[model samples]
Target: MGCGRPFDEVIAIAPLQRCHVMLSWCYLLLSATMTIECLDLSECQAALGMESGAIAAQDILASSSFDEASVGPQYARIRTDVAGGAWCPSTQIDQTRYEYLQVNLHRVHVITCVETQGRHGGGHGKEYPTFYMLEYWRPGRTEWQRYKGHHQNVLLKANFDTNTAVKITLDTPIVASKVRFVPFSEHLRTTCMRVELYGCEHKEGLLAYSMPSGEFYAGHLFDDRSYDGSRNSSGFLTGGLGQLMDGRTGGEFALGNGIVSDAANAEQWVGWTKPLVEFYFLFDDIRNFTALSLHVMDSSNSIKEAAVSFSLDGRHFSHTLVEYFRYENSSVAPGPDWLSIRIPKQCGRFVLVNIRNTGKLLLISEVRFESGDAYDVEIVTDGPFVGRISSPSFEYVWLITGLLGCCFLCALLVTIIAIRQRQRKVTSPSYTGLKSTPQAEHIAVDLKTGQMKVIRDTELWLPFLNAKANSTNVYMFDSDKCAVSKILEAPANVSSVQPAESASTTPLIPLKSSSSEEDSHCLSRKELFFENMRSEYDNPSLHYAASDVRIVPLSKAER
Candidate 1:
C-alpha cells in the first residue's frame, strides 16, 4: 500500500487520509485481480434478467406462492419491492428443510454472483432470507446437483432486512440453464426473497468430451473424481465432462492445494499411461476457435508433444497444428506447465486433443477455450460445465402443440359422449315409452261386479287352479300319499240301473234351484258330480248320494 514506508511513518498519516488510502489500495487490488474473498468473479458482470426484465414472468417458479396473483415468483427481483412486497412463501419455513424460488434461464450461462433482497414493502416488510443454498441443472445432467466448491457444501449469506440488496459473489460460479434458491433459517419465520444472477453467456459451447480412463499411481488414484460422464466397459469415460472445465484449476502438487489426504494431488490431475492419448470434446454447435489454454503438470515434460484437430462431424477431422513441448528436467520432482496453443482461424463443432507421451506418465489439470469476440463472457471453470448449452429447438414446440391439440379433442369427445349418455338416461324409453302393460290388457274393474261375474260366468278358472295345484304337488297337507284316492269317491247307491238303447233321449237329473237367473249359469248335473268327486270327497266310508249310476259294458248295436 506504501512505497516501502516504515510502520512508524505510516502511522503518522492522518486517520481520515489513511482510510482514503486504504480504500484506493483495495480498489486497485479488486480491479487488478478481480478477486474478492479469494474468489475470482472473472469480471463477467451481465445481469441475467431478474432486475433487468430479461428473465420474463413465466421463467420464475416457486415451491409455493403466498398469493399467485400478488406474491408470486415473478415478483421476485433484486432491488425492487412490488407485487405484494417481494415473493413470500405460502407458508413459514419453520422446521423445514426446503422451500425454494427457482428461475429457468432458458439456456445455460456462467452465473458468477447472485444478489438478493427481502420483502421491501417500501421499507415495511421484515421478511427476508437469512441463508440459502443453490442447486442447478444443465445439459448432460440427468438430475439436479447441489454446487459444492472444492467439494465443500457451503451456504450463501442473504439479506437480513428489506429493500437494501446484498450480493453474494460465489468463489465458484455456476453454469446452468436453471437454478433454485433454497432459503434456510435457524429461527422460525416466514421468508421472502428477490434475486438476480450475474454472469455472461457460455459461448465456448463445449457440451461433453470422451477420454481414456484415468490411471492409478502409488496407492493413489490420479483420476477426475468429478467427471460425471459415462464409463464404458473398457474403463474409458465414454462421454461427459467434469473437473477439467470447473474454474478451480489444479495447483502445484508440491504446494498441497486442492489435495485429498496427503495426496490431494492425484485427485485433481487427469492422468494416463498410454504413449498416444486422444481427447474428444463435443460442442453444442459450431464455434470459432481463437486460442486454447491448458494447465498441465508437465514440469518433467512427461507429455512430449501434442496435435490439435477440428472437425465439423466427429469423424474426418482436419489437422490444425502440432508442436513438441517435450524437455528433460533433472529436478527431484517435476512440476506443472501451462500451454496456450493458438488455433489459426479454425472453426468447428468438435475439438480433438492428441497428446503424445514422452516419459510414460502424463497429467493435465485444466482446459479453457478463449475467444476474441466482444462476447468475452467468463466461463467459470469452477462452476458446472458438464456439457454444452444447447439452443431450444422449434421442432419441440410443434410437437408439444400437436400433443395438446390431440388431448383437447379427445377430452371434447369424451365430454360430448358423457353429456349424450346423461340426456338419454334422463328421457329414456324405460321412463317414458309405452304406457300400457305388456303382461295383461286393462279391464274396467269395479270390485263387487268383477267378483260376481267371475264366479257366475267362468268355471274354467277353478278347474285350471285345481289342475295346477295337482300337477305342482302344492297341497299335500301332512300325509305323504298321492291325491288319486281323494280324487275318486264311490257313490252311496251302488245298485245297477237298466241301460237304455236306441236313439237315447236325454237323461233327466234333478238339480238344486231352477228359479233364479243363477240356475242358468250354474254347472250342469254331470259336471257337479265330477267336481264333487275331485274336491269334496275327503272320506271313502261316509257318503251322501241323491242319485246313483252303474257302469255298463260296451255293447255292439242291439247285440
Candidate 2:
C-alpha cells in the first residue's frame, strides 16, 4: 500500500496558472482516492465572505482614474455573467451617493422590477428579511429622499420563488434631461440592463386631455378642493364674487364637446372658437377691490389664458393684457394659460369681462372671484367720494340752502315795508285845539235861486279843522251835532228830506230824492260838479291839483 498523506498536506495544492488545468484534474483524483467528504460553507457565510472582498476591491478600482493602460483593457475584457448561488455582486455597480445618469426623458418612460433569488436567515440565520425600500434624487438635489415605489403593498417571503415588481411614478411629468436612482435595499443591487422612456415631439394644437371630462375637475376661488360652490363638479372658466356677466347671477358656458379621451388618444384637437358666455360687473364702490384673477381650462384639462377686459363705465372696455401665469406652455398650444389681472386701485362700479375661448376647449365648468386690493388709486378714492357727494346728502344740502334763501328774502322785504310805514307815521300831519266849553256854532245864509246855507258845530269839525283845503266853496260840519235853524227855499227839483243815516250803509249817495218830480233836476246839477272832479283826477293826459278839495278839511263856521 502507498503511504497516506496528511489531509492538510494533500489539500495544500499550488495556485494554478494558465496551464494548470491538467494539474487540477490530477489533484482532484488524488482527493477522491483519500475517501474524504467534500464539505462547503453555509450559503450565508459564503455570500457574505465573497461580497465583502468583492465590494472592497470594486470600491478601490472604481475610484481609480480610467487611464488608457489600466481601465482600457478592463473595459474591453468585460463579460456578461449570471449570478450564482444565493447572492451575486455586480462588478460594474456604482456606490457613490452623488452619481447620476443623464438621459433624454422627452416622451420617454421607464419600468423596473425586483426579484429575490433566495432567503438569508436573520442575524446570519437562513430566513428572508423584510427589506423592501426605494429612494430617488433629482439632478439638482444633493441627497436622496425616500419614495413609495407603487400603490401596492410590499411583500416578502421566507422562501421567495417568484419575482416581485415595484413600479415608480415621477412626481412631476417633465422632459427630464437627467435622472438619478438610489436603491433602498441591497436586494435590488443588480446592474441596470436597459432604460426605456416614452414621449412625443412638440406639436401645435395637440391636446393631452379634455378639460370637461370626468378625469379633470374644476378649481375653486376660495376653497382649495372645490370649484365654485359645487364639490362634485370641476372649476369654471372665470371666478369671483361678481363673476356673472349680468352682475351677481352667473351664466352658462360650454367647456368642451362633452367627450372623454385617454393617453392612447392623446394629442387630439379640442377648443372653443368663441365665448360661450359673457359677464358684466359694476362695482358701486371701487375702493373695496384689489385684484382680479381667472381660472380656465384647456382641452387637456389644463388652465390657459382667457381674454379679459375691464371698464370704468360699462359702455367702454379696456382689454387687460395678461402678464403672469401659473402653468408652463406647451409647444403644441399657445399656453399653460390662466388669466389674472391685478387692479392697482378700485375701478368704480364698472368692470366688464369677456371670456374669450380658452386655447384648448369651450367647456367652462365653474368660475371664481378672488377679492383683491383696488388697482386704480384715483378711482378708489375719487369714485366713492364723488358718489357720496351726488347722493342724498348733497341733495339735502341744496334743499336746505334754498329754503334758507327764501326765508331770508321774505324777511328782508318785510323789514323794508315796516321801515317805510314807520317813516310815514313819523312825518304825518297833526291837528290842534278848539274852544273848551262851546257846544255848537251855527250859521245860515239865504237860499234863493241856489243860495247855500252854512252851519257850524265845532265839536263835529274838530278832527278835520286843521286839514288843508284848496277850494273856497267847500264847507265842513259834523252831522251828529249840526242842525239847520231854518228851512230855505227848496231847489226846483228838491225832493222830500232823506234820512242822513240809514241801517243799510252804502258808500255811494244819490243826489236826487225819491219824493219830488223835479228830483231829476237836482241830480243833474250834482252830476255836473261830480263830472268836473272826475275830469281833473281820472284823466291820463292831464295833471291834477297837488291838493284836491275833497281831501281837505273845512272850518265849522263854513258848514
Report lDDT (CA) for all predictions: 0.57, 0.27
Q: How many steric overlaps are in each model, in order?
A: 8, 58
Indicate the residue-level lDDT of 506 in model 2: 14
Residue 361's lDDT in candidate 2:
43
Instruction: Please provide, for model 2 over 1-559, each residue's C-alpha lDDT reduced to its tens digit, 9 standing for 90 to 100.
Output: 0012221121122211323353354333332311111111121111111122321222121122223242211221111112211221233233332222222222212112222222121223132212323332222123433333112222222122212222333222221222333222344233221112222221111101112212231221211121111112342322211111101111223323443323211211122334333444433222223344343334223333333444433344443532222234343233223333544332223454444444334433233233322321122111111001012345667978999999999999999999999998889633212211122222222211222223245355334332332211222221222312222112111233222221111111122222323222222222111112222112221112111212212122222
Cand. 2 Cα-lDDT: 0.27
Give the TM-scores of the predictions, in the order they appear.
0.50, 0.21
lDDT of 1 by residue, 435-485 (tens): 222221111111111110111222422331233322111111101110101
lDDT of 2 at 77: 11
Q: Which regions of candidate 1 deviate over 4 angstroms?
A: 1-41, 94-98, 139-143, 152-166, 184-189, 212-241, 247-249, 253-277, 288-291, 315-336, 342-347, 370-559
